[model samples]
Target chain A: MGLQNAINGIPLEWYLIVAAALFSIGLYGVLARKNAVAMLMGVELMLNSVNLNLLAFWRYLAPESAAGLAFAAFVFVVAAAETAVGLALIIAVYRSLKSVDPETLTQLKL
Target chain B: MTLQQVIFIILAIAVIGSALFVVTTSNLFRGALMLIVAFFGVAGFYVLLDNGLFAVAQVMIYIGAISILIIFSVMLTRGMQAMIPRNAQAGSVAIAAALLFLILLLAFGPFRLVVDLSGVPILSALFRTESARVLGGVPWQFANREVPETYIADFGRALVDLNQFLLPFLLVAFLVDAVLAGAIYIARQRKPAEVIAEREAIAKEEAEELAALQPQPTAPTLPQGAIASTADH
Candidate 1:
C-alpha cells in the first residue's frame, strides 16, 4: 500500500463523466468559434478528452492487456501530426488574407 | 472524502475549468495559455492512471510542442489576441452542446445501465467478460487492472507484435513522417515580397556592421557607396 492506496479508487463513471463534459466543451468551441485556430484548439481539447477516456478504461477495465494503452499513445501521435498540419494551413491562409477567420475564407482565390 | 478522490476532483476542476476558458476567452494568446493549463491537467491524469511515461510525453508533446506551435501561428499571422473575436454563434453552440450532453448522460444511465441496453449486446459482453476478444480470438486471462509495473514493456510488445498491434503502429509512423514533410513545405512557402524584405533587412544589418568596424570617415562613405552601388539608377 502506498499514498494512492489510502483513498478508495474513484469509480470509472466519474472519469467518464469528466471526459464527456470536456468533450462537450470542445464541441461548443468548434461550433461557435469563427477563428480557424480556435476551432483547431477545440479539436485538440476533444482529442485530449478521448485520451482521458482511453486511459481511464485502461486503468479500470484491462490494465493487463496493453491494447488500451497502445491506442492512447497512438492517439497522441496522430494528434501531434494533425496539429502540425493544421497550424501550417492556418499560417498559409493568414499570409494571404491577413486573417485567420473562417467566415472570410469562404472562397479560394489567387 | 478520500485523498485519491480529492486529488481526482482537483485535477478534474483544473482540466474542465481551463478547457472552458480555452474556448470562451476572447484573447487568442490567453486561450492558448488556458489550453496549456488544461493540458497540464491531462498530464496529471496520466500520472494518476499510473503511466509515468505517458504523463511525461503528454507534457512534452502537448505543452512543449503543440501549444507552442499554435501560439507561434497566432503570433506569425499577427497578434490574433488583439483582434476582436467573432462570438456571434456562441449561444447556439452552447445549446447544441447542452443537447448532446443530455443525450449522452441519459444513454450512459445510472448504475452503469449501459450493459442492459439492447442496442449494444456485443459491447456489454466485451466489458463483462473475463478477457475481451474480437470474433472470439485467443482469450486473455483476467488480470489485475492496477498493476503499474511492466506497463512500458507490455506497451512495447503490443506495438511490435506482428499478430496484434503492428498494423496501426506502422501506419502511425508513416503518417507522422508524411505529415511532417507536408507541414514543413506548406508553412515554409514564403511569399516573394516577404522574402525580398527579409533579405533587404539582412543586407542592411550586415552593411551597418561592416561600416561600424571601419574608421568613422570611411564608415559614412561606405554605406552611401554601397547604397549607390546597389541602386538601379
Candidate 2:
C-alpha cells in the first residue's frame, strides 16, 4: 500500500517544480546565449516546459474536461509554426549577414 | 520511493541536463543533438502522465520535424559554431535566472518547511513558512475521477465539434498553411539573374512613377485627333 501510494501520489507540485526549473534554464539560455539559433532553442525549451505544465494540470485538476488537452494541442501548433518561421528567418539572416551571431546585427542599435 | 517516482526523477534529470547542455554547449551541432535528447525526455514525461497521444505527437513533431529543421539551419550556418559561446552578460543572466528559479520554487513547490537562518534574523523572519500562495499551496479544484478510456477520442471529437474547438482548429490549420508558405518565401535562395531581374523591374516601375509625377518639358502633347492627321500626312 505504501508503495502504491508513493507511485500514484506523485503530487502536482513535483511537475510544477520541474517545469519551473526548466523555464528558468530556458530563460538563462535565451538571455545569455549569443547565437541566434541557440536562443531559438531556448525558446523551444520554454515552450516545452509550458506544455508540461499544461498537461500536468490537465491530468490532475481537470481530466474530465478537454480544455487542457485542447490548449496543449494549440500550443503544439503554435510551437511548430514558431519553429518553422524562426528557423527560416535565421537562415535568411545568415544568408544576408554571413553570420549567425546576434551581436553582429547592430543595425537597430542607436 | 515508488517506481514511478524513480522514473520521474531520472527523466527530470535527463531532461534538465540535456537542456542545459543544449544552451551552454559551444558547438551548435552538439547542442541540436542534446536538444533531441531533452525532447525524448519530455516524451517520457508525457508517457508517465499517461498521455500516449501527446508522447507520440511530441516525438513526431519535436523530435522528427523541429529538431531536423534546427539541425539543417545549424548546418546551413556552419562556420558560426566556432564563435564565443556566451554573451558578455552571461554571469548576470545566470544570477537573474537563479533568482527567478528561487522565486518559482517558492511559488510552485511544497515549500512548507520552517527554517532558521543562521546569523541573519531579518532573512529568517522573511523566510518564515507562510503557506505558499500559488499552485501547490492553493486548494484548487481537482476531478478525482479516472480519465475516461475514450479520452483520446473525446479530445479528437472536441477539436472538430462545432460548439467546442472547431473554429480554433480551423484557424490553427490556416496559420500552419500561412507559416509554411511564408517560410518557403523567406528561405528560398534567389539566383543572381532573378535578383537582377527583380531589381530592374523595380527600377523601371520607379522610373514610370517619376515620369507620371512630372511631365517632360521637351515632349509635345498630341491632340485627340492627331493620330488621324499624322496618318493623312
Candidate 3:
C-alpha cells in the first residue's frame, strides 16, 4: 500500500493494520503449536505486535505522548524476563517428564 | 519498489516461512530454531517502523537469550536422536485445510483495504526535515507547547519516573529469580535414586578388588617341595 495519510504526512493506519495481522498470526501460532517453547514464541510475537501498534500510534496520533514509547520499552523488558522464567520452568518439566509436549504436562490439566 | 516496500516483503516472507516451519517441523529443536528466525523477522519489522531500540532488544533478548535457553532445555531432557511423534492427524489434514479456507474466506471477504497515496510525501518530508538531534536525541524538558522531539528518551524517563513502574520492574525481577530458583530446585530433586545406588555399588566393587589384591602368606615354596618329594617316592 502506498502512503495514504499524513498527520503532516504520517501513515498510522497502515502500521496499525500490520500490527493487527502480526497479532493474529501470533494468536494462530499460540493456538496451533504444541510445544511450550513455541507457544512462548507466539506470546513474544503477540507482545511485539502490540509494541508496534503502540509505537505507531505514538508516532502518528500522539507525537507528543512519550508514554507510548515508554510502555513499549517496559513491555520489551517484561517479555525478556517472562521468556527466561517460562523456559526455565519448561526445562524443569522436561527434566522430570522427559518431554516438553504440552499434552504431557497434565499436572494442572483437569 | 521502494526500499521500505522491499524490506517489508522480505520480512513478511521470513515471518511466514519461519512460522510455518515452527508448526510443521517434527524435531522440537529445529522448531525452536525456526522460531528464532521468526523473531528476527519481527525485529526487522521493528527496524522498518523506525524503532531501532526495539529491534536491538528483540534480537538480544529473544534471539540470544530465549532461543538458546529453549534449545538447552530440549537437549538436556531429550537426546538429539529421539524422534518426535509424527503428526497423527494426517487423515484430518484435508478437513483442517478446508476449515482454514472457510475461515479465511469469511475473514477476508468483508475487508476492503483503502490505500492513501498522499500521506507518503508528507511523511517523507517529515522524515527528511526533522533534525536528528531533535527527533532522536536525548530527552529534555521543552518550554514550547509542542512535544519535544526525543520521543524514545522521554518514554524511557517516563517509565522510571512518571508512570511509577519501579515497583512492577522489581516485582518482575523477583518473579524471575524465584522461578529460576524453583526450576533449579526441581531439577535437582528429580535425579534418579538409582544413580546414587549405582555409585555406591561401583565403590563397593572397587573396595573388594583392592582387598583381594592384598599380599597373602608365602606357601608356594612348600607346595613345590612336597610335590617333588611325592613324585620321587
All candidates: TM-score: 0.76, 0.80, 0.63
Model 1, position A94: C-alpha lDDT score: 84
lDDT of each: 0.80, 0.86, 0.63
Query: Whole-model lDDT, candidate 2?
Result: 0.86
Q: Model 3, which residues run further than 4 Å from truth?
A: A6-10, A107-110, B79-149, B162-167, B170-233
What is candidate 2's TM-score against the reference? 0.80
Candidate 3 CAPRI level: incorrect
Off by over 4 Å in 1: A1-8, A108-110, B82-87, B109-144, B191-233
iRMSD for each candidate structure, in the order shown: 3.5, 2.0, 6.5
Q: Would you list the rank order by lDDT, best first?
A: 2, 1, 3
Instruction: For candidate 1, give the docking quality class from DockQ.
Output: acceptable
What lDDT does model 1 reach? Answer: 0.80
Candidate topping DockQ: 2
TM-score preference between candidates 2 and 3, better one: 2
Best prediction by lDDT: 2
